[model samples]
Each structure stands twice: as structure tokens, then as C-alpha cells.
Target chain A: MEFTNALSIATPELIVVIGAMVLLLVGAYGGDKARPAISLLSGLVLIGAAVASATGPLGQAFMGAFVNDSLAVFAKVAIYLASAVAILLGHGWMIRNNQARFEYPILILLAAAGMSMMASAGDLISLYVGIELQSLALYVLAAFNRDDAKGSEAGLKYFVLGALSSGLLLYGASLIYGFAGSMAFDDIAAAAAGAHGTSLIFGLVFLLCGLAFKISAAPFHMWTPDVYEGAPTPAVAFFAAAPKLAALVLIARTLGEGFHVIEDQWRQVILALAVLSFCVGAFGGLMQKNIQRLLAYSSIANMGYALLAIAAGTTVGVKAMLVFMVLYMVDVTGFFACLLALSRGGRPITQISDLAGLKQDRPGTAIVLTMLSLSVLGMPPFAGFWAKVYVFGAAIQGGLWIFAALGLAASVVAAFYYLRLIKLMWFDPSPGLTDPAPRDAQWVAYAAAAFSFPLVLFALGWLDGFAGTAARALGLG
Target chain B: MIAAIAFYVLAAVSVFAALRVVLASNPVHSVLWLITAFFSAAGLFVLMGAEFLAMLLVVVYVGAVAVLFLFVVMMLDVDFVKLREGFTRYMPFGAVVACILLVEMILISAAVAARGAGAHAPGVQHATDVTNVEAIGRVLYTDYVYIFQAAGLVLLVAMIGAIVLTLRHRPHVKRQDIHTQVTRDRKKALAMTRPETGAGVRPEDLV
Candidate 1:
């Protein structure tokens, strides 16, 4: 009976892993022609696993290593959906560049599997495993375009920084184990509640630093821009969306579950990181010429917003984070879809200068890019605006007025860069470069834009219910 | 008592070899030192009764990776003479750091020894039936399961990071197109050809 229960709980992760393995084998044998089918099949499998997770019992499983709950289900759904869209956006580029290999979809599926595992991780060990699984897949994906020098450089930079962070995390885990005598989240929590020692505190700080790097929060975000800029655009799109969502959920779970007793110790650390992330993300993006790098900084800022919600440690804050992340994912996907469609001869047109006069050559894509960029800048009637409003409101309700104010200031600073992109797209003259949108690329752009539209229209209705459900799931009244 | 002495000796050798891994002048020497370190570490692990990890470290790290490292180092055209020239400049600082580290280790060991043997905590018994490996495995698979899993993830990330850093694409070079190669006609690539005769060409040339 216990074995069956464990299997049931582990089923979602198992399904994705098995699917990924199958894809890997197919890639090994099927050659280039098998890429599209494999990609679609993997995407469908991810969606299926996410849906399956939703129907499972809502509690810890596998001897308290994995959790199956509404929160995990929700995060899994978001990650899977984003990954599916990213695969779709990548397809055209892959085919055009003769890179439509089986490895591409398989790697994406593996990464998604990792994120799914992370979402369900109920203990420290499981969390680290999930995080590493996802990160490892992503590292490969980041430099998948092995022929591109920049891609290789990006991969190298990400690896070096990532290894250092992992070491820090391991040391932190060891310290925590030494202090608490257990690696289980509940055990750690119990120990922390009884005795809040210096070693435990230091361990928690290091742990947070490791997670902060994953989320690309400030002081630990130096790798974000370089990695994003150097990675293939589709990989960047995946990086900016799914992993951030998963990492944020993990952070929330860690703080809310393990360190609930020592909130005073961690709250200030989170707040400082949140502020730095916001400032850097907002202001740093202003000078970026590469669209991908700009989005990377933007992702850092957005993650900061999510962190703000997590830092609140209120039920409402958790709910707000879920809503904010969902909306952020949609907006970012739309933005990347536009960028992906603007590529020429399989090479991404990432520079801000390349986007000049885009309106004249590809009016539809330009319009979508404009809306997405505006939404990113938090314009009214867009999904991003409502997401920010709810998050900032939650901050205020939690009496974190200073954080709210800083967020608002950062948002204003961030607006200049988003608007600058819009201005170049609409007002600048076309550079007479051939339009890069093949037939399939156009479809991806349309799908992304169409998805963003509904998100905006349904934001109010979606937020109320999603927030309530998330709040309840988080045990916040 | 014999086991303890052997364990201490192996540990000391492992530490010494590891130090030499960093201090050795030539890259080849460094790799050799690393292999030695692995062997000593494995021996220490065996003394601690972790046969699996010991065997794995020997077979995988020492036998394969270290050997590969040695081979690569041997192949590279490293200017060992230049590398030696800088040794004098940094030796004093390096020695001081090493001394500090040794002192710290001595203090830690002395503290632990002072704590004495069989100083078991209350309600905690040293198991008599299971070996150290089994004891550790039991704890790892049960109580510390999450951490064990987390460690796996860290390794996975490291593996990916290593692969990504080393994988580079060069476009200018002429490379075989797998697609074209797979579909090529055998006759086109391996045909029996006749020699061409030119003006004033010899009969041997024509043949």
C-alpha cells in the first residue's frame, strides 16, 4: 500500500522522465525528420503529466520527500504550458537552421521534467535534485547551438557561476544537516522552531543565496544577461519563463515550510535581495542593445516582484505570486514569440537596431511586439499591469509599503526601455532587410499574441479565483 | 588499533597527494598527483568500510578520468620551463597559507581526540551488526533521503555545465554532412578510373 502511494505521488515525474527517455532514444535513431513529431509528442506528454498531477492526493508522499498538492499542481501546469509554447516557437528556427534534431525536444522535455520534480519536492534533497536536473538540461540547451561561438561562451559563463552557486548550496545543506541532524523539511522546521542557532541561520542564508542565483535576483544575477544574450533565442525564451516560475515556487515552499519559525531572520535578507533585483533589473535593462539580454534583466526584475510576494509570507502574498507568475509567463512568451518571428536566415535579429522600421516590413508582428512590450512595461488593460497591481497591493496589505514604493519606482525606470523598443518598432524607418518570418514562424507569433489577448481580458476574473484558491492551499486565511 | 593506524596513514597520504596536485610544476605531474590522491582516498574509504564508493573512485575517477587527464596533459605543448620560473615568486605566500591550513587541521584533530572514543550521545547506540557503509546507506536512504537526492541534482548540474563549457562549434572548417554522406552513391566515391594521356605523355602514364 505504501509503495503504491509512493508510485502514485511519483507518477507525474516518472511520466515526464519516461517520455524524455523515449524521445532521447527516438532522437538517437530517427534522425532529423523525427524532430517535429518528437517535439509535439513531448509537449503533449508534459501537459498530460501536469494534468495528472492535479488529480493526485494533496499531501506529502514518498516518505515526505515529494508533495502533491494544489500549489504544486498549479506550478506544474504553468511550467508545462510554457515549455510547450517554447518548443513550438523553437521549431521553425530549428528546421530552418538544420538543427531540427531529436536532442532539442528531448532536452526540453528533460528540463520540464526537472521543473515538475522541483514543484513536487517536499524535502531538501528532492528540491536540490529537481533543481539540478532542470539546470543541467538547461545548461545543455543554452549552448545547443554548438556552432555559435557566443552560445558556447554563454554556456561556459553559466557553468562556472552555476557550479560556484551549487557548491555554496551544498555547504549550506551540510551546515543545516549538522545543526538540525536531518534533511527533511519538517524535521528542519521542528529543529529551527526549538533552537534557532547561528549555524542554522548561516545555513539558511547560504541556501537563500543559492536559490537567489537560480531566480537571478540581485547581487547573484551577473550571469543572467550574458547567458541570455549568448543562448539561442528560443532557449532564452524557455529560460526567462519556466525556470523562474519553478524556482520561485521552490523559494516560497522553502521559506513558508522550512523557515517559518525563523521568519525574522530571513525576511530582511529576502527584502534586500528583492530591492536589489528590482533596481538592477529595472535600470540595467536601459542600456542593453540585445533584446534577449534586455529580457534577461527584465526577468530579474519580474522575479524580484515575485520574490516580493514570497517575502510577504502571507497567504495573500503566495496567491499574488501565483497570479503574477502566470501573467508574467504569458507576457514573456508573447514577447519572445515576436522576437523569434523577426529572425532572418535562422539567425535571431536580437539587436534593438535590427527592430527599427519593423512596422513597415511586418506590420502584424510589429503590432504584437508593441502590445507585448507595452504589457511588459505594465500598461493598463494588459495582463502585466494587473499582475503588478495585485502584487503591489498584496505588499501594501502586508504593510510592506517601502517595498511597494520601490517596486513602483523600478517599474517606472523599466518603462523607458520597453517604450524605447516600441518607439523603434513603430516610428523608425525599415532597414530594408529581408523579413525573417517563414510560414510557420508567423503561426507561432499569432498564437502567442492571441494567448496574451485573452490573458488581459480575463485577468480580473482569473486573479480573484486563482488568488483565493492559492491562498486557501497555502493555509492563509 | 591496526585499522585505525592504516586509516590515518591513508588519510595523510591522500592529503599529501592532493596538496601535490596543486603544487606540482608540470600539468602531467599534477595529473599524476591527482591519481595518487584518488588512490589514497579510495584506501581511506575502504578503511571506513565504504567499499562501493572506494571502488567507484578508483575505477572511475582514477582509472578513467585521471588517466584521460594525464594523456591530455602529455599531449599539450606546455612550456614547463616558463611555469617553473614563476614558482619562486609565489612560493612564500603559498607556503604560509599551507602552514595556516596545517595548523587549523591539527587544532581540529586535537579537539576531536580530546572528545575521546565511545562518547555516544544519549539514546544513540553504535550499531554492532551493520558495517559503516550499511549504516550510512540506511540513514541516507531514509532520514537524509532528501539531501542525497539534492546531491544527485548538484552532480547533474555539474555534468551539464562541464559539457556546455567544452562544446564549441566552428563553422569555417569543412566537415562531412551526415545527411549527404548517408545518401551517397558508392560508385561515385569509389570508382575505377582510367589514366588520362596528354601530348608527349609516356605509355606508362597512359597505363
Candidate 2:
């Protein structure tokens, strides 16, 4: 392909990259006062990128280093929009905390660019580059509040662990290249079909292990709770949403496009990670007192269901994974947005008890929070219910009803904590009214809550069709 | 014969230094050992005919990065003795992990030995006529240009992150207003004092 044609194929990522550099200059010259303007400009840039992605031609680019397809387009729209929400949430938060700087939004824009790369990555080299690009920005965002000891600690911990995971991924990629004589997914797939060797399986396991860390699947989930609790709430919202979706989609592409022929081998690894995630997310969440930590466990369990669907290694499974994540992504983004909005005594509420008597004073927020919690816990009539149904159905259709049953049982165990939050908000004694909700988070929470039940009813048909088409783009069934 | 012997000697010393980097109790000593390990590894790369890599391993790793590592280690207020105090307490757990990793490595090596790195030799092809830098340059720009640029963005993010974390503006502290100084008219800053040269400047004039 001509270089210009390849460049056209990656228009969305290019928009973000060039936009970030331009915004960096604006911020540098305009100083802190330029933050809000730069943020809005970046949002428009993202919208433009999304439009480009949705309308652009689909094909391999850069000699198959990148590919733009239905999967990439679908995932990019969700990620870019979520990245915008994250910037909005963080803007309100930094202003409230008196640490407003222009870099926050630019960092997020850069990270979104990285996520676009991940979604479109067609080769191991692109995969590693994308993951590192996303992770580097996040490490800085995690410690955005540098004065806070906990924030700095979170950043340092995430950076160290992220580097270690990158090492594992690189080693695995090298091994695969050594064995397969290729880096492109199509070539790797061809190589994998010809060989049923232990060395390849070993390399495959390591690669998936590295990816599992990205999605915060357990035993690799050790970083999520600390990072979520320590990082600024808005940054955590971004972490819990776009990056996870990008990683999950990347994993699906790798499995469906690259390692489809080695189903029995990679499936075991995926299934094992899913089961571990189920156990850890379920049992571990029961003991959490802090709200952020509880949400961390919730995300882990949600990823388990997604991974369970993915382990099926079918087109239906991939579709289910994509749908489940987009729904879960909105649920998590709104969930954290609510956390950003609610403050008791002018201090952001950290403890569960701080939410006591929340309904009495802040009835609207309380109800929205309740709706989100119920929706996320898979209560009937909510978006999460349908998400779970599709994933479980996919797993069963793939003849993995046993694992589906395990996921259901884990969901049962997980419901107790979600119920506990609801009970505290509605029934517990009054502490005090939370401060008035910030405009950004307030609007975000309302929009997210509306989607939690009724909007999903309206949008589910489109989402299901889009996700199906996206999954089919992987050339799997 | 000499090259083979030299490879063995470099490899042994490099491995020994790497072990010492981890096992040494003193943080400063460990850093120095890490630099030694880097040196020997660079020599090994040189022996393998990858002169470009050998240069990078020296200039990038040894010359720059290792010096920064040394600075951080020496500057940190770490209580190395206290840090190492938990060695005995966690030794059993650590040893179990170490053993598991060792076994896993052995298994992978065994698999590689039995199967001969599978379907092919390696992915990177070095032409006999082309120099190492030339081959790498061609691939870096054409085949993997997107990834190379993405890596540059990663470094750019690191730079932004350092500034964001460290840079703070203080309202009270005086700063250089070089632009203002440069645009100023000299008449305001300097007053003609022809009388002061003969009679000495009055205190009021000086003020």
C-alpha cells in the first residue's frame, strides 16, 4: 500500500496524536487558564476522530502493522467518547481540588490515541507499542495529584507493575517470533496452524498473561484496588472504562485473528484466568469497606464474565464480549462519576458509611446511584441483565455451560455487596447531606443512569447488531 | 578459536555480574554490578556481529541510563540495612517463587532444545551486503514507522509527566521578566549624572 493510503487508514489515531501535540503547545503558552478551552477543543477533536473512524475505509495499513475494520471502528467510538467523559470529570475534579493544570486533558487525549492503536493493532509490535503508550500516560495520570502521598504511591506502583508486565509481553512476543518467523497476526495464525508445539503454547500463555493484567483479571488484579483507591476519582473512572475495553478487544482480536486454530490451548488459559477472576472478585469484594475498593472488585468480576464469553472462541462469544464491555463501560464510567459528584462535609466521601442518609437529602443522585448499582449487579430490566444474558448464552452455545454456571454463582455471591450499598443509602441513619453535585459529573451521572435502564431498551438492538458485525470482522465463527 | 573462548569468558562474567546485581545486599554495590553486567553483555553483542546493538548497549544503557540509576541510588534516603532485614523472614517464600521460575525456564529451554525453535530460524533477516545500521534503518522507517513514532510519543508522555509532577508556580517568588527587561527604555534605568562625577553622587540622587 502507498504510505498516504496507510495514513488515511489510521486517520482517527492521527487526529488524536496531532491534536495532542497542538493542545500541548496551547497549554504551554496559555498556561493554566487554557485548561478548560483545551479540554473542549480536545473533545471536539475526539468527535472528529470518531467520525473519521466510522466513515473511513477498512483495510490493512502500514504493511499489516495496523488494520481498520468494524471491530476497530466500533471499539474506537466507545473509547474516544469515554475518553472525553473522563476529561470532563477530571476537569471538574482538578478545579475543586485546586490542582488544575492543562496537562491532564492532553494526557488523556494521548492515552486515547494509544487506545486507538491497541484496537487497530494487527501485529505484535503494534500491540506492545500501543499498550506502552496507553500505560505511560496512565502512570502519569494516576499520580496527577503529585502532592498527595497516596497519588504518588499509586503512580509509582502502577509504573513498576506495568513495566514488569511489558517485559513479560516482550519476552513472549520474541519467543513467538522465534518460533513462527513472523510478527503479523495473519502470519502468526498460519504458523500456529502448522505447529502444535509446547514452545508456542508457552509463549502464547505468557502473552495472554500480560494481557490479562491489562484487563485486571486476577491473580494479576493486585494493582487495581490500590490504584483505584489512591488515584484521583476521575482518573480511576478513565482507567476502569476505556483502557479495559481496548485491552479486552485487543485480546479478542489476538485470539480470534491470531490463535484461532489453537483453541484448546489458549482457551484453557482464558478459562483459568476467568475462573480466578470470578473467585477473587466475588469473595474479595465481600470484605471491602471503602467504596472505590468495592467498585474495583465489581470491575474484576465484570471482566470475568467478559473473559468467560471470550474463552468460547466463537463469533457469538466475541460479540457478547464487545456488548458486555460497552454496557459495563458506561456503568463503570457513571459509577465513578457519581463518586466524583458526591462529597460530604466538603470532603470527597471515601468510606461507605459516608453515603448514609444520602437519599434523604440528595434524592436524585441517590436514586441514580441505586439504579446504577442495581443495573451493574445484573438486576432484571437493567442493561447489565441483558449483558449477562448474552454472555451466558454465548458461553452455553459454545458448550461451556459449566463455566457459565460458575459465573452465575459468582454473580449471586457478588450481589450481596451491591445490595449492601443500596441498603445503606435508603435505610441507614442520617450522617449529612452531600455537597451539591458538580455540573459535569451531575450531567454525566444523569445521562449514564438514563442509559442504565431505558436507553438500553432503545439502543440494545443497534448495539447488538453493531457488536455482531464487529465480531464478524475478526473472520471467526 | 579465540572468538569462541572470548564469548565464553564474556558470557560467564556477564551472568555472574547479573546474579550479583540481585544478590548483593548493598544498593550501591548492586548498581555497580548492574553496570558491569551491561558492559559484558555489550561485548557479547559485539562478538555476535551486531555492532549497532553493542553501541546502543554501551552508549544508551551504560553511558546515560546507568549513570542516572547510580544518581538515584546514591541520592535516595533508603535504609538498605532495614530493607534487607526482611530477607530471612521472607526467604522461604522468595525461594519457592525463585524455584518455580527456575523450573519454568528449564522447561521452556528443554522444549526449545527438543523442537529447535520451531518452523524457522528467526524473523529478522540481515543481508550480507548491507551493514547492520542500514538494515535496521530501512525497517525502522518503512515497515515499522508507525510503531517507531508511537514509541516517540511514549517518551513525549514521560517528559510531560515529569513536568506535570514537578513543575509548580509560586505566586510569591520573584521570577525573571526578561522580555520586560529587554523591551525597557534605557532612560528609565540610567540617569545622566554629570554633576555627580565631580561632586560625588548625593544619597537622594543615588536613591
Candidate 3:
């Protein structure tokens, strides 16, 4: 590919890279004093990249190894937006803890760039590279506080489990190459359609296992709680929202597009995974005292819902999944925003008990948290509710009523934990510990909470058009 | 042909050293074995025409990861003396397993050799010009693109996990507060007291 064409094709990533480098230079020169300004600049650059990706021409590039399709464009936009929000939420926490450093924004930008690459990755090799870039940046971010033992332990567990998953994925990729004589998704689809082999199927199974780990899908999701609990709150927020969305999209792109021909083999595997994820997500959150761990379990269940839409393997299913993911990201971001706001002294307030009587102390944030928590549980008049409905509707259309029923049951189980959080915030007595409000955190709380109201109100009207466009873009119909 | 033979020999050495990395009793020995394994792997890569990866493996993995292992083992208070105590008991079973693995490898090699050279060779068109590095680059940038991308993501995740695992927060430890330390004034932190030498007070106490 010509350099200009490559630049044009990779503009989103290029923007982030340039921005990160400039921030790093500025940070080094300005020392600790320049971190806030650099972080804000990085956030703007991320927003710009998201906008550029949305407006950019959509197609394949680099010999079809990277694709710039509507689905990729939309997913990149979501990833960038989430990254921006994460940076905003993290700014206050970093400053308060005196851990605000140049590497923070740079790593965030690099991770965002990686996620963007992952979203558009058209071939397995590109996909692997994108994921590693994202993962490496995140690893640093997770353990950025070198003095914290818990943070270090979280990073270690995540590394070991992540390495094992990577090994599984690489072995699967080699097997796929061996069986299909090609690693491009398009080529694999064509090869697998005509050929029959056990190796190919086994490779697919292993590949799914790796992707499952990424999205924190059940059975492959052992590392989620420990990692979430161990990392700093903002890092956990970024983990819970952005990477999971990218992984889900990549999973859909691979299975829904590339392996559509062998749906019979993968369908059962996905169905089993979906059921397992749902049960685990619901039941796992119940016993969690730490809010971050609770959210981790919630993420698992949410992924199950997203997988349900994917399991349909229809165009409607793809659109529904996309809509669901977008809404879920917003809802989860809002929830984290509230958690980030609930600080005592200079430290972030964590643990379920820490949120007691938040309704009295921080009424606005508590209200937003309640709405967001309700949305997460699939309550009506919220974006998550509509997202779930579309997913269930897709499932029913595909005649997977049993899965839909399981989803409803899981939603109920999810509600129990979310409601417990709400009760703690409202019904419980106030701890009466007061701390000065951090300006940046207050803004994040307002923004996250305010964003959800419109999401809830406009979800129904928004879905039909969004779903139609997504369907057409994906060639689902 | 010579290059191919060298590659095979290096590859065998690398595999043997890697096996030793896991089986060696002393952590220090395991690290040393790992360094040798990395060197042999690098040599094989060079023969296969991956000059960049060969250099990277030698410089980064051997120089950094293996050295880190050695340093960590040296610094740790592990009793190497006790580790050797159980080796004799496990020797017979280990030997039997090694023999079975060797037999399987020989059989696999014979099967591959029976298929002949041309069976596994590239097509006639551009075969001479298609160096191993070029072929790998082509496949990586094209056919195996997603897998390559995924590998990077895995590494990134592993890196993050490592940091999270090692971070420590000690609540009770007394550490220097730079802000407070830097802002201290001589007038506030230090006092010059003048005591009266009277009313039966000792001179030392007054001073």
C-alpha cells in the first residue's frame, strides 16, 4: 500500500499516536504540573479521532488485512468515547493521589489506538497485534501505582491468565493456518465452506476461548474479579467498558461474518457459552462486597446478553448486538462515574458499604446511580431495557425462546445485586463523613448521569433507524 | 542445504534447553538453561531468514527476561539445598516419559521425511526469491493479520497484568511527604530557648 493510502486508512490510529507523542514530550518538559492540561488535550484528540473514524470512507485496506467498514467505524467511535470518558474520570483521582504522570494519558491514548485497530482488524494477525497493543498499555495503567501491592497483584494475575489465553489463541491460529492454508477471515470462510476437518473445528473452539477471555465470558472469565479488584478504580472503569466492547465486536465479525458458513458447529458452542455466561454473571455478583468486583460480574452477564444477539446470526441480530453494546457502555460508564464521585478524603470510595446513605450526601449522583443501576438490570424507560428487548426479540425471531427465557431469568438475578446497591445508597443511614468535592469528579458525575436520561428517553425511536443502518452496513438481511 | 541442516541442529538444541528450563532443580540453573534456549532459538530464526526476530529474541528475551530471572533468583532466599532432596525419587518416571517422547519424535520425523522434499516445498513461481522472512512478512501483513494483531493484544494484556500483580500499597509505612518536607521553615520547625540560670537550676538543665 502507498504511504498516503495507509495514512488515510489508519488516520484514527495516526491521530492518537501523534497526540500521545506530543503529550509525552510536553509531559516530560512540564513535569507534574502539565499532566492535567496534557490529559485534557489527549481527550480532545481522542474525540477528534472518533469523529474522523465515523466520517472516514468505509472499506478494506492493506490487502484486506484491515477493514474500515461501518461496523468498525461505529465500534471505534464507541471505544474512543469510552476512553475519553475514562480519562476524564481518572484525571481527578490521579491528581488527588499525586500519581498524575505523563505516562497516564499516553498509555490511555495508546490503548485507545489499539482498540481502534482491533475494531477494524480484518485478518487474524492484525487482530492479534491490535489486542496486544491495547493489552500492554492497559497492563501498565492497571499497575501505574507501583507502591500499591494489591494493584501489582492484580496486574500479575491478569498477566498470567492473559498469557495463557494468548497461547491458546496462537495455537488456534496456527491450527487454522494448517487446516485452511490461509489465515485471512475471508479465505478461511471460503476454505472451511468447501473443506471438512477436525483441526479447523478445534482451532475455532480454541479461538473462541481466547475471545471469551477478552470479553470476560463465563468459564473463561476467572481473571475478571481479581483483576478488577486489584486495579485502580479508573483503570477498572476503562477495562469494564472499552475493551469488552471491542472484543465483542471482533467476536461478531469473526463468527458472524467469517464462519457463518459453519454456523452449525459454532452455534452449539456459542449457545453453551451464552447460557454459562448468563448464569455466572447473575449468580457471581450476589456475594461481592467490592463494587468493582460486583461490576465485573455484571460485565459477564452483560456480555451474555450481547452474545445472545450474536447467537441469532441474522442481520437483525448484529444490529441488536451493536445497539445493546452501545447502550450498555453508556449505562456502565454512568455507574462508574457515580462510583468515582463517591470519594472520602483524597481516596476513591470503594466497597458496597462505602456507598451507604449516598442519597442524602450526594443526592444528584445517587439519583444518577440509581437510574444507571436500573438500566443495567434492564428496567424500562432506560436504554438498557430497550437494548435487552431487541436482543430478546432477535432471539425469539431466531426461535431461541429458551435462551431468551434464560436471559430474562439472568436479568432478574442481576437486578438483585443492583437493587442492593441502590438500597445501600438510599435506605441506609449516612456515614456522616464529609470531604471536599473534587471539581473534575463532579463534572464526570454530572456528564455520565445526564447522558443516561436522554439514552433512556430516545432508545425506542433511536433503535429502528440505527438497527436499519447497521443491518444494511453488515449485509445481514 | 547447509543452512537447513544448521537450522535443524539449532532447533533441536533449543528444544532440549527449553525442556531443561522446566526440569532443572535450581531456579538459577533453569534461568541459565532458558538463556541457552533463547540463543538457540535465535540461531534457528537466523537460519530461517528472520534476522529482525532473531536479533530481538537474543537481545530482548535473552538479555532482559532471562537476566531478570537470574537476578530475581539470586536475590530471593530460596533454599536450593532442599530442592535437590526430592530429585532422585522422581528420576525413574522422568526417564520413562523422556524415552516415550523421544520415540514419538523419531516416528514423526520419519513420517515427514517419507513425504519427500518437494511435497513440502513452495510452488515453482518465485520460489527462489521467496525468502523465509519475506514469506512470513507477507503472511503476517495479509493472511495472518488478525492473528498477529491478536498476539500484540495478548502481550499488551500480559504487560498490564504484570504491573497490577506487583503494585503494593502499605498504609502504616512512614514515608517522606515531599510537600511538607520542602515547605518546612527554620522558624517553625526549630526553637532557640534561652533559660535563666537561677533558683537552684542545674547549669546543664538550663542549657
Q: Write the per-residue lDDT of candidate 2 for residues A337-433, one digit (tens) a residue.
A: 8899999778999998888878899898889999999999899899999999999999999999999999999999999999999999999987876
Q: Point out where model 1 deviates above 4 Å.
A: A344-347, A433-436, A439-444, A447-454, A457-460, A471-477, B1-60, B75-126, B132-207
Candidate 2 stretches greater than 4 Å from native? B117-119, B171-174, B179-207
Mind giving the per-residue lDDT tens digits that candidate 3 earns over A391-444?
999999988999999999988988999899899989999877646666666677
Task: Give the number of the best model, judged by TM-score.
Answer: 2
Question: Per-residue lDDT for B29-95 in model 2, tens only?
Answer: 9889999999999999889888999999999999999989999999999898898899889989999
lDDT per residue as tens, model 3, B8-33: 88889988999999888888899999
Query: TM-score of predicted model 3?
Result: 0.81
Docking quality level of the chain pair in candidate 3: incorrect
lDDT for A472 (candidate 3): 58
TM-score of chain A of each: 0.96, 0.99, 0.96
Please write out the lDDT profile of model 1 over residues A1-477, one tens digit for every residue. 775766677677777777877776786588667877898898888888877776766667667888777788888878888888788878877777665556677678778878877887777778778878888888888878877899888877887798788787887787676667777787878777763443367678878899899889999999999999988888888999999999988888877778778887788899899999999999899899888889999999998899888788888888889888888888888787777777655466878888998878788998888877877788887778888888898889888999999999999999999999889988988777655576655776666566556646755586578556755665643
lDDT of 3: 0.79
